[model samples]
Target: MSLPVHLVPALDGVVVGSTVTVEGDEAHHAVAVRRLRVGESVVLTDGAGTSVTAEVASTGKRVFTAVAADVRRVAAPAPAVVVVQALPKGDRGELAVEVLTEVGVARVVPWAAARSVAVWKGERAAKSLAKWRSTAREAAKQARRPWFPEVDELASTADVVAMLSTASLAVVLHEEASVPLASLALPADGPLVVVVGPEGGLTEEEVAAFTAAGASSVRLGAEVLRTSTAGVAAVAALLARTPRWG
Candidate 1:
């Protein structure tokens, strides 16, 4: 099995034989929960493309120290994917974020779609956003990703249009679209954006606005998918055709 991975604030200048210390909640989980001890191997990453393989040297009440044995830096994948997911009711939002992060999405944008049933207001909005971000962080670690996906703040249709104006490829996941996702030619490099509507589906105006902003409306397949899983499925399909997954 792969060694347990812990996220650090920074991995810059980390070298073999150097000691790195982990503290706070991360260390507590390692020490108290995982029972990490001396001589055990682990991996530490900053989640921005740097990772180190290390062996535990010591443990404390709420902290642990490890000696770096190897360091690796990965280049960010080309043609990063950005998914704009409309809010789903209940805990489905967290599910979407978790799967998207595991699927290698570069960023997840929570969209306040017109037909969405869930509303993020005031404190609830902050908490929900935090939940999505926390979910992404945990999922990334579970997937052993050196780079974590970002969870963007709630956005409106207009906001999404402006955001994807420069994207090399953009697609709106509309069930009624004439084109299939597989039919589109994906860019080998640059930013790519995918827009997934809410449980109630997209408003006509919203679809038009996104299409006018350079996004092509495309259907994943003949069958409909839930709001929570549509983005993950679409992203998997798109990435399969890209070098990142090829």
Candidate 2:
């Protein structure tokens, strides 16, 4: 099995034979839950492209120390994929975030689309955003990703348009679109934006606005997919065409 990976703070300047401490709840989970013991190996990542392979050296009640055996730094994947996911009703939002992170999306931005069934307000908004962030973190760990995806604060349609306007390549998934996603040529570098509408789907105005801002409207296939899965499917299709997936 692959070594278990844990998220940690920055590991810059760390070298072989250096000792690093895994502490607090993270360490507790490793020692008490995973039962990580001395001499076993584990991977620790800063979630910003650096990872370390270490051998567990000692354990305490709420902390553990490891001797770093090797360190690796990965360049950020290109082109960076940013998914703008419309808020879905119920817990599907978390599901969407989890899958997008697992699929290697660089960032996931929750969009308040015109046809969204859910509303984020006050405490609910704060809680929902937190849940999405937490979901992304855990999903990244589960996927054994050294570079975790960022979950941005909820965005408005206008905000999304402005964001995509600056992207090197942008595509909006629409069931009504004539263009196929696979037919589009993805850029080798820079940002790639993918927009997935909510359960009720994107309004004509929203589609027009995004397209006007340089995003190409495209269809994944004949069958429609849930907002929770559409972004993941579209991203997989896009990545397969890029060297990032190879």
Candidate 2 lDDT (Cα, 0 to 1): 0.94
lDDT tens digits, residue span 24-75, model 1: 9999999999999899999999999999999999999999999999999999
Distance from true location, Cα of 110 in model 2, Å: 0.6
lDDT of each structure?
A: 0.93, 0.94
lDDT tens digits, residue span 12-114, model 2? 8889998999899889999999999999999999999989999999999899999999999988988899999999999999999999999999999999998
Clashing pairs in 1: none
The Cα error of candidate 1 at residue 176, in Å, is 0.9
